[model samples]
Target: MPLLAYWVTYASLDRAQTDWYLFWRARFRAGEPLPTDLSYIFLHVYETLHGVGFNRPEAAFAHLQRLWRSYRVDHPQLDHHLVDWLADFIRYYDLDDEVTRAWLDEAWVHAHGDLAVHYWLERGGGGEVPEGVFQHLISYRPEQNKFYRDAEDKAALDTLLRRAVVLTDSFYRETTGESVFERLKTKATHTVERRAFSGAVFEGPDFQYTVATIRQYRQDGRLSKLLTQAVRHAENLARKQVGFRSLLRDVKLPANLAAYLDVHLAPALATLQPPSPVQTPPAPERPRVQLDLGRLATLQQESEQVRGRLLEETEPGEASTDLEPSISPAVPATPALPAAPLAAVHRPPLPAQVAEGELTEVDSIAEVLAGITDAARDLLRQLRNQGWEAPEGDLRLPPGVFTSTLVDEVNEAAQPRLGDVLLQQQDGRLVAVDDYRNELAFLLGTPEPAALTPPLDGPWGALAGLLSPLHLEVLAQLLQTDLTLGELEVFTTARHALGSAVLEDLNSHALDTVGDILVDPYGDPLTLEDAYRDDVRRVLHASGLVHPE
Candidate 1:
């Protein structure tokens, strides 16, 4: 309907001119009859007759008469259709009649009076059959039975005969107080004793019909598609394994379908193939960060700046004679009054940390250490290929880094890694944001360098942890084997940590932390100097970083 509407709406053709319509137009206009085998007519007649029964002669006779009237002798094609239709009409109807009479004959063989047949025969009222018609039925039935038995083909009503016996066995058991099984056995024995086993009683299983088996029996072409669909359903249900579906597609049964197919197909079906496996990828490498205070001094001077500021104070009255000794500023201090021109100098963005002038003796030392720290971080970043080269000059640090209270803040921030020792003598504040990268060896305190701890992560008694991340890794590498400073730099590269370089450089400067120096790999009583040298020797031996011996 949608197709029809689409054509009507879009194409708006005056008429359909497909081959069928065009040919039909010529034939009708020319007064030519439709060919019997024209696609339409054949389908029409064949479809019309499919379910019309041929169970009786009268039925076929009526159909034949109808066809005769419909056929026109002038139209040989239509006449030919009637002829084929009649031939089929006769075969089916006659075969049905023959089957009905044969069933009756089996019940009344010899002179056995079957009240059912006599009653039905009398009701059929053919007036009088031929004198020996009853005899003929008897003789024909036995003869057919003989032919069937001789050819081993007496299965015509094998199902029906079994059905009748089942009914009889039930009747005998239910109505006569006899066991059904015993009654069936008794019937079978009598038949054999009478020497009448041709199509006789025997042990036969009750016949069951599946829709598929019925379709196979009929050999129905249209039903074949439906059967194939059913087979596919079975196959899918079993995940396309063998067994029932395999036997269903067989042309005919051999021996027994269940037993044979089970033997062949069950095992095949049971062995279902599994899906294939998938592969996984490898892990990525970690980032490397190592600090070096000495190399940093090379980048920017003022190693003492942050250390100086760390001790400086911003609070009122904290500046003393030692720190505020006659200092001058670009702007004068506010007059000693609330309404003065300005109460405080709105200082520019202070040094990256603290003001150098505010620094005290202890803060001065911390500021220098802080400067060293800043330089180290810078150098490590550069090594990571940040590509920020240090400008050549006196290592003067940038100013804002030394804001009045800022350097102390930085010292406090970096203290966790460098330790409270780097803190001002007054308030030992920790400020290292990421202290994990600091030299942990001092935190876990020991005379022996090997006693150099990794990091005090948790309470692990007697096992002092090194807080310096660089020291731990470099130590780990040295533990692997000895290495040198120049070589230690290469070890730093492979370790992929700027922290490794940071540890090596600290030890290299020999001013703080372990370095590329030599000592017992074990925690032998060695100063930072000796341990530093041992690491340097190991790095050298490993041919890690290239430099003169």
Candidate 2:
């Protein structure tokens, strides 16, 4: 109908008295070929008929069947949408007659049985399948359905198949006196060959695959061959160290087969043993030596007396008030020892006092050393005694003190006078920089270290005269070990200047003084050339930048 005539007819009709079926039927037949827009209108009519059709089951089924057949070829998906409707119709109206059964079978075939299968599985696969529905499901082939061939659809189908198998197995067992597999195996003509096995039954790899495959075979009514194949495959895989116990836990089998498999496999499982663990021998304990406290105190007093006498003798005519007299008045005073010859007394150079109340470089260095805490001083003494390097744990520090923080404190205290950091941490140990070893010892009142002599003649002597404190410090660091750019940065002036700039300045000084670049400026880790190492050390020692080991 044209839009004008269609609306005119709809407006003229008394809705309560109008026959909607005949009205739509006339509209559908008016156009020799139905208009495409009328298809939705026809579906609406079908829905209306379905909703009201239950009151007259025969009349509704006949009308829905005629509409379905008329539209099914052009609208194949119409059957998919009608699956639940048809199922409900048959179930609600109790329509199990031959005519209704034939119509439902044709519908199932047209819809590929996906919705029909889903409908039954949704109901827990219980109750009797309406006539023809079971036959269609049993005869349904998944490979032919393009929808089921898709990956997602295939997974859904597998889930449905598993549920169906479980439901069928449960129902069959409840209805009959035996399991599905037990009844199916009665027709087996061949015997299952037994094999030697050392593992428990159903203990193997790919157990899920075995279980799923067995379920599929059960659905296909082929359990007789499946049981024999599963046992043989499990035994073969067990020989290669795969287990099969997971399969039996997931898949139930006939009791006779279970007992037979257990009898053969359990003996081997019992004989298997786990490997023993290896044992290690215990380490020997170190001996502990206890100190005699009384003897130690006496020795310490005598040592203090000897040190006071030495200080008194070294600084003649200057009363050494640094120590109190340790000798007891109860004992007679010992005769004063004869003074040593002047040539025998080797006094280290002491810092000169400033008259203007301003510290000179030497006084500043001394003051920095004097300000060191007893803990820091002890740490330094240990490092010096251990050849200037000791594991951080071996050095005694107060609780809650970190070695790096202590090193930074000492270095910061000395930087203005020393012109560089004096201590470094390397490879988990505290190290006194070599350049300040003797200077530190002299300040601490320890014996002076032996002088290390390197050739200072000719060009080397000139180079020594030209090097600055910072330049000498940089060379000394490189001499000990090659330094990365970041490590060299610490020695740069103010510790903020670029390492490359420091190298350029040093190279310029060397090129002017000795006519050679003493260190490689562009190496990945900067290195001092071997030929110039002796000359550089001689410069360091000449300027008192480094001390002998």
The lDDT per prediction is 0.31, 0.50
Candidate 1 residue-wise lDDT at 442? 19
TM agreement with the true structure for every prediction? 0.14, 0.21
Candidate 2 has an lDDT of: 0.50
Off by over 4 Å in 2: 1-373, 377-455, 466-497, 520-534, 537-549
lDDT by residue for model 2 (213-266), tens: 011111233542344333332232232222211111123455554444444444
On lDDT, the leading prediction is 2
lDDT of 1 by residue, 68-142 (tens): 444445434444334334333344334355544543343221111122223323444233322222221221122
* Model 2 deviation from the true structure expressed as Cα RMSD, one decimal place: 43.4
State the local distance difference test value for candidate 1: 0.31
